[model samples]
Target chain A: MKKGRLERFLESDVDNILYWVSIFVVVLTAIIYVAQIWFVNYTGRYDLLECRLKTMTGINCPGCGGTRALKSLFKGDIFSSLYYNAFATYGAIIYILFFVTQTLERITKGKIKGIKFKMVYLWIAIGVLVIQYLLKFIIPGYKI
Target chain B: MDNNFNEEPNYTGEVVGEPKESGKAKASMICGIIGVVLCVIGCFCCIGYAGVPLAIIAIVMAMMSKNETDGELTQQAKIGLICGIAALLVLVLGFVIGFVIGFASAFTGA
Candidate 1:
């Protein structure tokens, strides 16, 4: 039986499509984050996305200061970034890894190694969120 | 003692087990799991936006991989696809609920 065009495409080009889509997503995210940082730098206002939890409950959520953290990190303020949101540093590292992996996979025609999200990484991320949440309470005058 | 049959084993066109699973299927499954995890975390934290994009990517990858594979591997891809879609749904629902609540509060001047 002869395969249809869609079937042929699914069998042959799907891998390439996945690879390219991943690359596009990572690139787009990086661009957006950079633009957000630029906006914050110029406006001195961190109002990208409002925190619904904070607004409603008058309390800091685990990710309340994430945008500020990213902005501070971009501005070379490591201490301030950590004070704002520790996960920003780890998120930045993950973003860099995603960008490199996707770029390398494309350049090497999928010959280079591909990366997988490990369970350990997820656990570490969750742990960091918890730790940051706890620190927000323990540290005096810790503003979200 | 009649075991003197010396015939060569015919190994031509024999039925083998299912085709070897594609690496893409495995990748799809992993991505889906990660997406679901991120979405769950995002629901509590403030990272729902980040998870939504990842969930979309995972769903796409799973669909592509599902098209390329079959049998047990297809099952794996299906799991990935379901998880990815569920994560996206969770994120979208959260956003909608949050928006409605915020709007109601503002409208009521609460």
Candidate 2:
């Protein structure tokens, strides 16, 4: 007939759903990345969807080489990772940090704190966007 | 019929205030701007994929405004949501049909 602290907290919170959802997505993306790398190595080919996309479209989408970039990073091939998608390696770092922050905040129920690096993050994001676009135009034979 | 029996109860929960309406409105406004920007970009650059999701998100955020307690932003949310939804529908339908027909033709060699 008695309830615990965890149950009481859950009853009071609406944000738990969002928090859990964020964790799920982060975990799922990581799993998918692993599977994709295995498939790529086994087949000696990237995704057929992306291959066809590049052949037909003649220009790369922002997320075109993100998977390859992640794969390369995991394999410790820094130059290959950059070649695949420079922004993506950095993106994975940010994603992991985001996941950790959200998880900590959710578990603490309001006591957890966050860093104040907004301006720096904004500048870095803008820089990456510009660099990605420039590299698309400048770098030859590095097509995504 | 059970609505009469289940009359709405007055607020009696912990007094944690809801998220600010301005924050929600700012989010909706950003989504709308991004949607329009994507649509334009897609049109000019022939990459409609980027714009479709943006438009959808904008519209959903806009529709959420109806439930918002922010009086100042209600109209903005409604308009933005409606426009975004409309744009997304048009673009998605147009692309789907085009792709279907093209694929059919390619397969049939006609």
Candidate 3:
């Protein structure tokens, strides 16, 4: 069967695509983090970006505090990350493990089989999010 | 593509020429489904950006699956890839629209 250009690219350029995408993410993260620092220094009273849902609805959404959690994670403060948003904190840990495992499998050329990414794992993660969501409302004096 | 990746028959007990799916492909499919679902959940409020990451994950997993396995996406993985792309486009579009609105409001003092 003949292949189209897009098909050929997808088949042959998987590594290149992943590489560029990862590079883009890293660069974007760096830019956003730097901008955030500058904004904080300049404003001193407000964050540069605000959560739309919280601002509009006066209630925390499912992913509230995710940005703070990510910032704390980037700063290597795991406890603060978890305090900000347990879901994002745990999700980052899981993603790091997944990424490391993927890199190892590629480096080893599949000689060492890493643990399979199971559907059950995602379900468990969702379960944790649901628990946290309920607790945010149930517990008094809990930060959003 | 290594046809012998599957050492045993699947739950259906069907031993075909194609082996069972690698974890990456399965993850791709799962992430794609999640991405689309999240995008469909109304890309307003806090949910607007939720699907973007999942879509990226889906596409990445599909690419990795192709790289490690058959050099071609599995049927499910291809579906995942398409869904991921669709979700990404929708979410990004919503983000752009939101940004434009915010900018206009700030300029107009509204």
Candidate 4:
């Protein structure tokens, strides 16, 4: 049977799709990071999205300090990043891995293999987030 | 050699010989990609509420595709399923925690 146009395009253009998607992700992240810097500088506040959980419940969510953590990491404050949200470090690492894989795939014309442990990596990320939440709840003075 | 040249082309047989690829698998892969992208956007922009529905949709499509696919295509569906589930879990967990805490504080007057 003759393949549909969409199917043919998907099968044939996967490399190009992956390459462009990677670029898009990287560019978006960069833009967000830059915007965050400007927002913090002008507003004198780190968090743009006020945590609803914190505000309504007076308790931190699992991802409460993730933004501040990323901001600190981007600003090169490693200790502060960990202090605000340890999960941010893991998130950053995963993002970096994704960026590297995508960039490499684009450069190598799909010859260079990208990380294939798609589900495993995702599960690991989820596990880390859960662990971070548990640590914050169980350990005194361990803030998330 | 002359007998082979005399044979008629079996167009119907040719069409039937090739297996039809399932659209479900393709839809599953597309939904998964969209779900992951939206999750990233939601996380970065702090608008996770907007991403939850899309993630759920992605998970549903991926599961539907998973049953129809095999091998590498199955792997793609699995990736989508995992991504969608992860995004949904994160959002749900946050809301659940927030509500629980809110109720606890209300009862305790703390």
- TM-scores for chain B, in order? 0.73, 0.53, 0.68, 0.54
* Model 3 score (lDDT): 0.67
Which is superior by lDDT, 1 or 4?
Answer: 1
How does model 1 do on interface RMSD, in angstroms?
A: 4.8
- Candidate 4 C-alpha lDDT tens digits along A61-131: 65678778878989999888877877667768766776688678768988987653244554576677678
Task: Give the DockQ ranking, best first.
Answer: 1, 3, 4, 2
Candidate 4 docking category? incorrect
Error of 2 at A9 (Å): 13
By TM-score, the better pick of 3 and 4 is 3
Candidate 4 lDDT tens digits, B1-110: 55553344576654233334444444445546545544543543453344555566556656655444453446556766787787776656656765787699899998
lDDT of all predictions: 0.67, 0.55, 0.67, 0.61
What is the number of backbone collisions in each predicted candidate, taken in the order shown?
Answer: 0, 0, 0, 0
lDDT at residue B63 of model 1 (Cα atoms): 67
Q: Judged by DockQ, which candidate is best?
A: 1
Candidates 1 and 2 compared: the better one by DockQ is 1
Residue B88, candidate 4: Cα error in Å is 7.4
TM-score of every candidate relative to the true structure: 0.63, 0.53, 0.56, 0.54
In angstroms, how far off is B14's CA in candidate 3?
14
Give the docking tier of candidate 3. incorrect
The list of candidate 4 runs beyond 4 A from truth reads A1-9, A12-48, A110-112, B1-110
